[model samples]
Target chain A: MLNRYYRVQAGPEGYLPPAAASMGVMLPEKGEALVEGIIVSEEEAMQKIAEKIVNAKNPVFFPGPNILWAWNDSVLEKAYAVNDLVQSSGARVIPMPDYRPKYPMINPEVEINPNHPNLTIWHNHIDVCVFVGVHCHYANIALKIIRGGTDCYTIAICGEAGHEDAMISLRDVSIDTLRRLNDVIKSTGEGLK
Target chain B: MNKGLVKISPCFEDVMPQEYKELVEKGSYGQDYGVADLGSFKELIEEHPLCAGCGLALSMRLILASLPNPESTIIVGSTGCSALAFSQVALHNIHSLFGNQNAVATGLKRALKLRFPDEIKDVVVIAGDGATADIGLDMVMQSWFRRENITTIMLDNEAYANTGGQESGMTAEKAVLNMAPKGKNFPKVNLADVAQVAGCAYVATCNPAKSRVLEKAVKRAILAAREIGPTYVQIYAPCPTNYKLKPDEVLATVKNREKEGTYPTGEFISAKAQELFESLEGGSK
Candidate 1:
């Protein structure tokens, strides 16, 4: 194995003299390694180091066994780009976004003011709908609303299951997605365009 | 528009009574409950708007405080929910392009060691599986291989949940993790093995269900980083949606995952919990 490594040849500009070997590769006038008739350059060393770091593990990546979950309906171009860069830094990534938008679809069994119309939209498309500020969790339902399959749009989404309970369903990204995937209609008469 | 006499409230806190405002201070249920430990959850989301989901999205409150020093700290996030952790910080933080966290983290670490190796702050990175396994794998390998002195915690949920649960490199071999079927595949790359081979001497794996174990791992990683070296850990967190488990059944499923060794809680090979997971290769034979 060592012979294979040493047999690569460094001659003339590629040969490594004894003093140069002791000093960790003394370069010739060409600024390259002259060992076994083969030359190694500074740029090659940097690339090797870069490659090494790209494969190293143990940089503060994640706490453990967790992913960054999204609420669905995202382009994820930037996410993929970033992932391409960091895995080399030795951390893992996880996502948890789309567990379903907090749509305010109250159970019909519950007796509430039927006249109090729900004001929310459902969206599910390859693009963002409604507005840019709409949250992504609403993408699926927003898609549902734009299809006109149901009445009473405009509902709020809340964090689910014993978590904080509230009623404001305007996820930020639904608007642009809605615009892209469907036609834009005037919002409810409460002054929200 | 009339000269803007809209009469905004004096203190937003005043609109809500002290009791309601105190909600951010009081303790609340966490993983044990169907909800997160939302006392910090609300504060984090309120403070960091770009925050992502569930635990990873909102865990920054704990992570920020856990960092030995925050004021001097420069945070970097790769491609996962961890990226959102610092994203909300509109100031005093740096968010690098994805997959370069290991690289960025290395730069920060080297700059720090050169700058204030005496008394410096931590460089915490929130990375994801795809970022770690494929996209950023090279950078990660480089950092630990050089022993670049950083603390890395890998959150391995076995699938890519953020991008609608795509199959990541960490997904179990011959198991279905991605919701959309890419068909069954095998030979899930053992990140621990890769880390080990890449020269991560101090490595550990822990389950989020076991927070104490996780906390200890955090401490160990931090200490290792402080020693001017790199430390690696793989975390096994659970996902209610991707796991195909009901909301109520998440804990059991998480526990089951740990017991079944799909997530491999404990040390990866020779670190601390070796005896617990030595024959741990999921019977690939």
Candidate 2:
């Protein structure tokens, strides 16, 4: 399945367990609970996301305005947690090119359009792509385009319901959710080390 | 506007942006796509820089998706929040001076008609209410009066949102804003009615809250303008930032306004446009 989807060579360790395929379950009774069109617990989704990031040869984090725009201190803390997650996972961060800086400094190696994720992924040779703090509609558009056009495994950390197009999407993410994901990635990275 | 024009050369396919490659292969250029097929295909507009829960962004997304022929469509935009998003759209868009979108579109459409007399080239003018109903009202009306072959769409946020939330001609009566400190003294300019009176073949008033309805209206307006005459679609995309409402509260505000008999949504088709739609429907059946 990985050979069928991915064009670029994956990490030396090979592709991690197929997150959606490994989960033996039908669609959730409530559609909102679906991650990658299947019902998966939030913890399980986070674990799968961490595994992909930890195992990816070239992982990139594309943070949208929602993550970087700090209207208050809580949002700023969430932004910092995102940065920590990127650092722990050793993933490069790319912000929307048109974004005017607001708060919580982000050092983006490159700029990407949230609507055209495939261009960035193809240019950067990213094997695993994560999107956080993006508006739901824009994220939906980007994830679909990435799935249709590229081989990168896409993850959407959404503030609302999870995205069906992403490989593993964490829904209703709060600051705590960000910290927990970061911790999980950190532990997984430490174990690998 | 030829579909073949977007084809990537085999030699440059590896280096061309993946987006261009996908657009040629999977985009809804000549395909039958609507809001229902959103997540399954490559959308035209790329990432937008509008505020979260912006009604204008949502409306633009729906409108772009509803275009009957995107490959041959040339969008004419003016200075506003819509212009910010226009830069990222994959289509050939012209961002002329503020309030001069109609004038530019008129020239572009005429020139395209002369060049591609055989092909269908859609020239769409999309601008904010300030540009449509105030600063460029005369030009917009002139285009309608001349029966130019173009579709004019208004992203009516009701206020000059990009300029820090000032009052526009489309602002509702008694609405407080930066310019209208106390309140707007006049009622919102009914651009739909004006378009009807000014000899538009098709006129529709819609909001982003009703996606399917807005989609049908956009399709009808664009299709009507192609054969009938100039058409207009007024979209009541409420500005969440200027309205001092939460981002998620935009749809609810639109629904509430509709219920209160304030911003109603309706459509008017001239006799010719109605006949054209009937003939097209008959052929499809």
Candidate 3:
């Protein structure tokens, strides 16, 4: 018998629980380690993220569609937290251009092709790129390209599991997580000044 | 396509898009990528415009990740919500007419076979239920009957979600929508059974609620279509907008439906395809 998170009950016709249907198949495990390629506590990861943003000459926050969509009640709070972080850290917030037309228009100041992060980094001379509320798969694609072809450091503040490819990954991030990080960045930046 | 074609020119290295450069350096061209390898490597799909928590979008992401040969594969899409995301796919994809996906795949597969006879160029047709079960049922069935070496996958949202919520052939009986004001008159189309009868070498009915199951079905369908004949995989990708369900509620709804026996996941493989899978599994073991 397989252990399932959801309770299984017998139904009428051909319905079988996912565990039974997927017998002998190995499902991908959800990873909880906040940072990848290194072991660190959640507080340590947050400190590292704040330090990178505060120390960088030019840092930009790339907010993906999840920040705009009202998919859940926490999303609006997440967006507000991101705004607070940008304000405190003096980071430029760029909404990642999406195919959807109704949402935010492309920013004329920075032409950041979501497919090509290096171009944006090169054109704007961005030193650090912080990704928040971006879908996991898309973020993975961008992070790999940025790491492989650009000098800009990458940070991912994910709603779920941490990204293994990101330089500093804050996993299961909530509004509190963002607020705490923002406080750290403000203090760090003030100390530097 | 030659892998070197995407390589950045020495002179244009400073100007070429970083994505193309990364594709040459770390893309999943000849390598094997399963669901477990998702966030570790560069995915073929970029940011999509789909709704938040859209099951169709998640299904597309998982399907792309599960492709056995992403480099050599060409996707044939149709007019629907899925078409919007096709533009962002890193692999070569064609958005055909609303109901002409299989027709397009047939020609594309034949032409690619002629162009590269020795190479394996897998042509796949991915469309919505409205396009597959109703609009292009004839063309889709004919392709399977002819045993065209292509895979046909239906992103079954159960209604015409791209347009305002309209009743589609795949919509379940008694489901109220724009066209079906009172309720849908007929039960959902039995597309899986029809595919089996229409000479499909392998057939499956799955949903995104079971990502691993969906992944295995997609991988098997593509692999079977490579040598065996036509293949079909119907994925129940729920439409949160049209269904009036919250984004996060879609997966739970699918799970509830599965438990209630309204929608179940199963597979049907021909003897030849079964033999192929057994041999492949044995080798891997």
Which regions of candidate 1 fall more than 4 Å away from where they truly are?
A1-193, B1-65, B89-93, B177-182, B268-285
Worst 10 residues of 2 chain B by lDDT: B8-17
Model 2 pairs in collision: A115-B47
The residue-level lDDT of candidate 2 at B104 comes to 99
TM-score of each: 0.46, 0.61, 0.61
Candidate 3 on B113-214: residue-level lDDT in tens?
A: 899999889899999998899999989999999999999999999999878889999999999887668999888999999999999999999988898899
Query: Judged by lDDT against the true structure, how good is candidate 2?
Result: 0.79
State the interface C-alpha RMSD of candidate 2: 17.2
Task: DockQ for every model, please.
Answer: 0.01, 0.01, 0.01
Backbone clash pairs for candidate 3 read: none
Best by lDDT: 2
Q: Per-model i-RMS in Å? A: 19.0, 17.2, 17.3
Query: Candidate 3: fnat, from 0 to 1?
Result: 0.00
Q: What tens-digit string does per-residue lDDT give for candidate 3 at A74-173?
A: 6666777887888898888655533222113333344354566555676787888898878887787666667666668888888887676576777778
lDDT against the true structure, each candidate? 0.43, 0.79, 0.78
Q: First chain TM-score in every candidate?
A: 0.17, 0.76, 0.74
Mark the regions of model 3 whose C-alpha exceeds 4 Å error after superposition.
A1-193, B2-5, B283-285
